[model samples]
Target: MTDTAPQPIDLDALPEEDDHDEALTTFRARVGAFELHWSVDAPLSVVMTSSSHVGRAGVGLIEVLTSAEQRGRTSQAYWRSAVGERLRVQGSHITSDGGAERAVIVQTDAVSGLEVRSTVTAPRGTTALRIESVVRNAGREPVVLTAVSSATIGIGRSSSDLDRVTWGSAASEWLAEDRWRETPVRELLPDISLPFHGQDGRGHAGVTSHGAWSSGEHLPCGYLVRGDGEALAWQIETSAGWHADLSQTRNGGVLSLLGPTDLEHQFAHELLPGESFTAVPVAIAASAEARDGVIAGLTRYRRWLRRDVAGEALPVVYNDFMNTLMGQPTTEQLLPLIRGAAAAGAEVFCIDAGWFADPAIGDWWSTVGEWREATARFGEGGLRRVIDEIHRQGMSSGLWLEPEVVGVDSPAAARLPDEAFFQRFGRRVQEDRRYHLDFRHPAVRGHLDATVDHLVEEYGIRYLKLDYNINPGAGTERNATTAGDGLLAHTRAFQDWLVRVQQRHPSLRIENCSSGAMRADYALLSVTHLQSTSDQQDFLLYPPIAASAPASILPEQCGNWAYPSSEMSDDETAFTLVTGLSGRLYLSGFLEELRPAQRDRVAEAVALHKALRGELADATPFWPLGLPAWDAPTVCLGLRTGSGDLLFVWDRDAAPAAFTLPDVSGEVEVLFPAAPTDGSGWRLATTVAGLSVATSAGLGARVLKVRRG
Candidate 1:
């Protein structure tokens, strides 16, 4: 503890010897906006504390639990492990480049021979940092790692007031995705009276995601907020399995993050000598601006993570799947839609699913994987004619592809080797009516590689909606140590394949869609150009998903569907169109069959999104009405831009009312449905405190442009 501000010092530079062997030697370093202080004493730890506020700083830097060794903690929580406490710090240093500062700390458990090289990178002008660790089996014998930490840090208000903090988490599903809830930390981890008993609490609060959907059931992101306007946000970047926990550590609250664990996901890695395993990446952000500001910081961190992958122009895409073709697109059905999409201002027309199946047979779910045109369904030039028609209309062509699965009835099932499929207990992994392919296998990779190449070269396709519809449970144990380790390696290998595909065809745009937003994590979005935010068809349910998606996904990458039909009222069409306008507009439905007014509305929405999308690329998303709840009558999402702010408001059965929006002022105007009678009805005025928005009730949404004066 120092009275004056601490200065940068060597992390391993121990202080003068003290009489007590357990005496702590404190080291301090400024990493971006965070002032990290660590103790190079017996149990190595790091904490974010500075002159303004002191947070929980005594967290064990890393934790590794193995099958043979004793469980780290007496409780089931993955913290305070014997290995974590015993691991001695080896070396550490800091490096700066590209407006970010990075710190590398290496440690090893001499008995277990596990060497963990942990890195923390903070982007300039942001109060957040990205943390990840690579563990290597430095010993002579193999070790079955049951659980390894990707990020282990302490978070909360001052140590004494930690229990007062509240945390927000997400519950995701196929149709109902991005349902967020905020609860007090005490509600999950109550008061165990650690000081009275002199022991850390046994019970813990946490979130875990299993199977292939990195964001299924629960998103791999959450936030902790203190009453003092201080906040900490975190996201585990993985497309496979992930786990995060919040537990008491006597130092306040410890947030432990891991990829997969034997205790939870049947994931155990048997690391051989010299072989290394890099855990999934996790980003942690801190802010004095409360929950929204912390999320804005994470948005910045995500951009920093995608430094190599450039942001693409947000194109209005028309897919013939939702509420339209329903995945059974025939040449007769798609030709008119392609022409319609082009006329309605869609830059890309996608034929979603059923392109290679015969509808006569019905429910072709069990006969996919062979990416070929079904000759009988399409007339004349077949699928190519539809694609050519799209090109002739001055729009790019896109196709739906589920490259990860092979159906039981498909010819590809017999063509690929058994080694190419996920093997568990000597049998290929089957879920629903399909078998999951092991991308690590050359045979499997080659098959998909050729399929993509054909689509890009022969078909002249510019966009691809790569959809993943099934989860193969635990992972393949074919060529790996344990099932969990295999799953982790398999996902990582798939990322490599995506990189190769993008490198081969740099101009092509690949969309990341996993049964909707199930797999919308940074692991895939970092490489892919766009993310399908959800599969929810009801426009009423979509506002929450689109408004809340930016907490873990970038606003520019959120491909929220805007499917409008001829039957919908003008107001209803505007409602759905505004959802798409909130992020990257994904168009669909029967645009060609719509009345002139309805069709004109869709075109106008596309034109508006195109004009304002440049602001979306660098904008920071905040929820003026708080993170959208599934049943919230009114939901609001605000994106802070350089010139001003763009506010997206949704009203679903809420009384015609007004709620104050935060940090927005100056002149305001309705951007979409520009004319009052065109469809939208809204009022916006800059209040003395901030901005006031009024709207009509019953399923109406509006996008307002706010210019700060």
Candidate 2:
């Protein structure tokens, strides 16, 4: 925590020599709990490894692709490029980022005039290293970069170790999000016995995201572990395209993380003379203690990255969207919901989509712009009346907005010029009959800024639910060399615009919802107040998502939806409430239509959340039964806080049985189902190492408070 910056120690044994000599000079620097080794030689090689790691071998420092020098080896592809091996080390130094120590290494390729300054950052008190590269064209001519790596590090010491490794990452969809997959490394990459042939393998196994929805298909976080359980987990923090992979090299097996490339995402960046391009930020957390430990380290880093979040400054929100209005909102439907939400202790009431739609205008699906209130919907006063009702109920009002797209038939589509929209090949990019707006264009930014200001100023809103529905493949060709480059620019501009909007309304809270986590990357979370975890309507399917989301997102930012309807039994209603209690507790469903007991259940859950939210904000998440599977019968999540810890367990479709929680012996009580005579037979008792949970069978859940003695 001291202001004294870290110094890089020279570990090279050889004496000083000219750059022309074949002699090697190596240096080391300790960043947080990790060590980085920099070797200055013919081909500059840098290895970032856990300080406690048994091996120090790793791949080259940089893997870059230029228009002239493509892949050096078909076998190495993204792992090995001609320019990467030709770049000679210029210098290495230490720097500081917000008081935390960092290291920057400089390398240059004279032929291409690509000067790369790779910066390594260690967030204080976390075992993660944030890596980035800034490539400047120092030559007299321009250089087109087809690809560049933010981080390339060895994950294995030898071929045998590579085969024995295991890896896992989360796969996501609209309703089914954060489904984790773990498998043997051999399944993804086959060992070609490189030592016998003295060659690096050409083929690689990797995950690449295209289009604007960064997490639409797969999350940008993953991990690799060897047989002894030494593990490394990483996350690429970008809202646009990203790539990460594992491949074989002469030195060892390396994991290369990058943001957008010509070969994959149709991304190309042209750096003119004296100009520079910075690669996306990627981070890695290593743990000698393995999978769970590295995941914990990654969680801690995610926390440190967004420590200035203002979500806790806001109040719990109740939106009439999931399993309720479903976008068909009117005066009759909303007044009752608003009253019920307020009665159930919701501090903010959000009216989801369709508020501005005039059903008389041909269903108004593709004509949703204008943000004007529909007079026919609310008896002349329209949305203002609804907003008034929300205010009268003593709750702040919020609205849902898909700010990045304009319906093709909307007046905005014609008002904004073609330059404001994303266009490729002389045509606007239209997906699902909606045109994606390029945030890089000033007109687009102006329109969104005006829309946000009008909504906040007119309605006096305290919260905004910003949603993105379309994934415009690649990006526009208006102001960039490639589609990927344009996407990168637009994403950056969008985040900047978000910052400006927050500045305009300092007390306002923003929620990032991309059709439910299709774009839940850190670029948005780092700026926005909260993230909608998923759009999953079924309560039966949300436990796994809520349980596993802490691996990549902070528990405080997870916006798990809880919609309890009159159709659900008392136990069923309580089950969904537990899911909401796990995270930010986004409430929904028809509370006004429920019976008195059902309303009491909702009220009790909301009350408990308000009491424990202070703890949830600073707590660290852990799994008692490990991370849950999609259909796992029993799922348990524990939150360790400065105050007594909290444990959440779900008996999904399992018969009434007993399960054990590890390393958690304490005074335990069911915070929910506070009254024991409710006939659920759920009891938490102390065991030798932890607690024994025996709950009533046939789909039930519990919220238990644990005070360790």
TM-score on alpha carbons, each prediction: 0.95, 0.94
Q: Write the per-residue lDDT of candidate 1 for residues 315-416, one digit (tens) a residue.
A: 888899998988888988888898888888889998899999977868999999899988878867888888889999999999999998999999999999
468: Cα error in model 1, Å = 0.8
lDDT score at residue 504, model 1, on the 0-100 scale: 91
Candidate 1: residue 321 lDDT (0-100): 93
Q: Which pairs in model 2 have colliding backbones? A: 75-202
Model 1: CA > 4 A from native? 1-25, 35-40, 49-55, 70-72, 156-159, 677-680
For model 1, the local distance difference test gives: 0.82
Candidate 2 accuracy as lDDT: 0.81
Candidate 2 differs from the real structure by a C-alpha RMSD in angstroms, to one decimal, of: 3.0
lDDT string, candidate 2, 530-555, tens digits: 88989998899999999888877888
- In model 2, which range of ten residues has the least summed lDDT? 13-22
